[model samples]
Target: MGRTLGVIAATIAAVTFLTGSQATAQQATSSTLTMQGYGWKLTDIVGVYAISPSETYTITFETAAMKARYAPYYTEALKQIRDAGIHIEIGGVEPVDINQCGPKNHIQVTERYRPVGTPGWSKGVPCPWQPQGLGRGGLVIYNSEYWDGSWYISKANLHNTIVHEVLHAMGLNHPNVDLDGDGTVEPYECVATSYGNKPIMCSPSGGYHTSNMGKLVHFDVSGLKALLANARAQGIS
Candidate 1:
């Protein structure tokens, strides 16, 4: 299992900043900043995969059809991620059997993704409430079982989901949560005004949002930047 020390340490560090010169520095840097006050435990190494130039990372899919559907968007999203200096190593896309759709299966998948000697499925299955892992090199298993029939899994939704999960893997918690001592995190009541009217990152239904341009966008620059900054602060590659 991924270690929890990073999260604890990050929390402590954030809390420390809340009371000292660090707080002043933070305030001076960006007023819009709101520290989420959470951290991730480093369970695996962060690296880039799939795309060439050895920069962009990829999400290995379970089938060619799945890749055909999601690759384009994944490629685009990855480019944005790379531009931010984060290198994601996407394993080659492959087909995961139907048997690998449940919690236990996901655990096994996590093991495959984790480096040798690192924590793996032996850590116990992940809680259903938390689809993403608590470690640095997190694994997001996308199975048709959870999304096949759901409208939330549309092409647009897939893009958003991948981006959102990638952010989670990078150690960014939900921005909707109030971590900067604010009373509460932003809430999404509907797709219309969700994600601060940005992209699908904070969408209401955990998917895509309707855009004025009639295009489906997954994340806004600000949200992406925030996530990147948090990942950097946590020493995530």
Candidate 2:
């Protein structure tokens, strides 16, 4: 496992993505989580963060109504993570005071029904100087635009969007590989598998579509395990 991680790290660092080109890449400055190669500012190359098994991270919604509305979607997303055998209890439905939503550990999800081409259309962790590490949670602003009629996205897309953004808060970055022969990493450029095209961490636009959306592939689980293993190695458990 150590050998494999070493290879992955080296390969990721070696392949340079086109900086400031893709929408997600352009968001480098304002977001808490960096793009592609730089996993999380709080975590190391080994994928260790300040997270722990006993910690119960609360994922509150921008409004209680939104939470209730998206309840089933959230449940399915949580089930994917929990089913991976990772010890993390994640579920909550509370309307945080607009003023109180600025805390580091206060993880809230907002709704901005922006157009598809907008810069932050489906982005998360908007704050530039957000808290680092596991103990200090983050924010996720999903594009409610996707929830409207089938202009661009579907419910499955929205579900994956939730998982993707939440994972970013947990210190995951886009697995931005140069899938195409092109020298630059464009939007949705990630590893392809027999199952589908996108890894969950793929940015701006993720890989899976309606057919396989909301499913956690092996690559996704591996990312989580990488964090836990690194934490364990550091005697965090």
Candidate 3:
């Protein structure tokens, strides 16, 4: 597992895509709960303020409607992070500029409708796109189709996508593996528990379903703990 987590040291950026309801997906064979490799931010030219924020990143939504819909879901998922000793702030509705990294310790969430085939798309975390300043902020734009009923996804899947993208904004990447031993890693191919639970951070929306999708799975929390551990080692604690 240590060797697997080593990917966190070097990988520069990541992209999290939620698989559509019709997308073919497979789960890892393992039945027991496990934590796998997912890259995170260490240091970058824009300055790694993500792991070591001056204060803490405050989550802001693009509009009141977005906040009303997703903020509670975020609170549910962020509980794991806070309980693990990592902290982030939740702010109120505000206009977001996805084009540029905004204020320091800020997370701007917006909504944009992508192409029909695309599900939901979000960028890497720890401010991967920051080209300058201490702006440790990133953008997370959910696909409008999820709400417009154009894309038919379960409520669980929709909530899981929110957590997945939020984790990506915090520097976690897809812990994709060759689950089928086909010598090729595919999207949403991640380890799952015996009960059929996969990491919430899985590339194409792998996590709890039919019950509750607003909570972080053990595997996902393990990744957050790993990030904090790594940050502490880097003297960011």
Candidate 4:
């Protein structure tokens, strides 16, 4: 896990300033940015999505055609999240299950392709009253259509996606940066990195294509750190 984090750190350290098109999207602190439609919000993390800092949140995978094949990707993503200082753990599997999500403390990983606007999406289990409130647990659904495409998405990309969506299940949203000043957020427009951009939460187009991308970037770690800090404030830890 440390090695995975080290790779991301090195990648961020090596990122050079943007030259032409991407120059407008300068690297900004995650603490100040908000999702475009979410009203001048800071980073996408919310207090309700936080898990008990004192507990290891268990994660399970539902039986699906892709579960065995893609389980490792989700597993690696969880390790990377844990490495980022968010407490989490893997749990049991339910065979031939279909949306019996429960317990409100465990995460269920499943596969499905829901192309609403992006390739993947996640929702906290038991549902939260508002997008900003606390959520006890969640669901991570992989868009298999995006995964099986011919677009040459590397294992790094898969891992990045898993990490990104899992963070969403924990109540993180896309780190929006309206680089064009159109009063709208664009995908892959968050904090900049050497290759172009960073931030696993950068929407459909963020993160490096290199091995470094498989791990959480600096901003991602910061977001989780912020969540943990909030947990402390709420007396969850």
Candidate 5:
């Protein structure tokens, strides 16, 4: 059975809230953070303090109820990032105003949050910060129409989406490891063996073709390592 890791609460009170002079000093002197897990090496350029303090990575939900339901899963996913040595502070979930998103590439929910055919829908768009200015750094919007119908969004898929997007923000990419020599990595594939199963990083509509919540997913360690090495080579981390 797939294991659901427990969440780790943020250690906000341990240190005096650093601001102004102290914050600047911390930024100037902070060391590069490196985490080695699942054979992948991940590094952060701005360090932990910058990412968490400003709470720059915000999640605006479609409704108050959805925010409450997804918050715990989001917390759990953030804990995984923390475990990976990437210090990230999650902002409180809030209702998203469609006007605020404008034309920015963000996750869109259709159908009502049910299967694609239902009245709700959900999708991730490329944001500006994406590599090469390519589609990246977009918003992920979820609607009730999509989540309440066929192919309901589960806690696992919601949690996995958070992890996947955060990793992207950190400059990681989907690994190029397709052990079966099939010339492609199936979505939600297991990374434990040479078989190369589906991964959450893969396109939601492609690969193993399972319900979003049912796919067993995790990071591609080697791919994460390559990202870290690249950042280090560029002196960004």
Candidate 6:
């Protein structure tokens, strides 16, 4: 059997931050800046998404299919996260122990490319949710039927999806909020510049979809920077 969390409550939840999607189970914070639809939100992490300043995440592909599908996006996303002072690398498969918050300091990602109506796709599983709430490593999946061209979404949406899910794996949750105070968080709820750019980490779906870049936005970078700050606080690095 895998290890147990004991008293941690294991509030392990999945996130994709548009206002109308996913979980908010044990997240410790929210976007304090409700910029009238132009703000950023944040959360406390509990996975291998962070370790210390000295260590690299070394994310890897579980299969060649997954590699072929997401290597480019991972390359784009990791560079931003890495540039922000968090160490990360696209690694080859080695001895990864992905048994529900295993302690191997590795993140393994796989794309299932399932068929339509196959429950769903695009899931991110971050590592241990400890009392300290820092990233150690975990698994990320974007097993959507869209990969096979069965589901039709724009390339921009696809790129944003990968970036969003991976951030979840890196331990960042959706920061969407009710800027309008409409009593409900809608898909368009999170931050948006005057030109309409939402955080890639926005739940449900949002990002630089106009250009099909699928890279992290400024708000997303703030979250990663927050991770580094938290890591420093906990003396991880």
Please report, in order, the local distance difference test score of every candidate based on alpha carbons: 0.35, 0.50, 0.58, 0.51, 0.36, 0.60
Best by TM-score: 6
Residues 85-109 of candidate 6: C-alpha lDDT, one tens digit per residue: 9888877754333345434556777
TM-score of 4: 0.67
Ranking by TM-score: 6, 3, 4, 2, 5, 1
Local error of candidate 5 at 1, Å? 20
What is the lDDT, from 0 to 100, of the residue 34 in candidate 3? Answer: 21
Per-residue lDDT of candidate 5, residues 1-237 (tens digit): 111101000121122321223243233432343333352322221121112211123444455565566555445545544454433454444444332332322332211333223232343322322221122123344444434454455555545654454444343433324557788755433344344444544433211223333332454434343443434443444
Better lDDT candidate (5, 6): 6
Work out how many backbone clashes candidate 5 has: 43
Question: Candidate 4's error at 233, in angstroms?
Answer: 1.1
lDDT, model 2, position 59 = 72
Query: Candidate 1, residues 9-40: lDDT per residue as tens digits?
Result: 24334332122233333333333333332211
Can you tell me which runs of candidate 6 are displaced by over 4 Å?
1-51, 94-99, 113-120
Candidate with the larger lDDT of 3 and 5: 3
Residues 1-237, model 3: lDDT tens digits: 011112422332333321111111112112221223542222222233224422477788878988888788887787777886666878988777554555666777777776222455434344543322122556676777778777787788877887776776665666777879999977768888788888877766678895667688877776766655544444455
| Model 1 poorest 10 in a row by lDDT | 42-51
Q: What ranges in model 1 sit over 4 Å off?
A: 1-58, 63-65, 94-135, 143-155, 178-196, 203-237
Q: TM-score for model 2?
A: 0.66
Q: How many residue pairs clash in each candidate?
A: 10, 1, 2, 4, 43, 14
What TM-score, computed on C-alpha atoms, does each candidate reach? 0.43, 0.66, 0.73, 0.67, 0.47, 0.75
How big is the positional error of residue 110 in model 1, measured in Å on the Cα after superposition?
A: 10
Q: What's model 6's TM-score?
A: 0.75
Model 4 Cα lDDT, one tens digit per residue, 1-237: 011212322332333421112122222113333322321112222223334566667666776444565556556556666876767776677542324433555666776655232434422222232222334555566666656573355566666776665666665556657878888766555666566656766766455567666566666666666556655554555
Global Cα RMSD, each model: 12.1, 10.2, 10.2, 12.7, 12.2, 7.8
Deviation in Å, model 4, residue 138 alpha carbon = 0.4
Q: Which 10-residue window in model 3 sums to the lowest lDDT?
A: 20-29
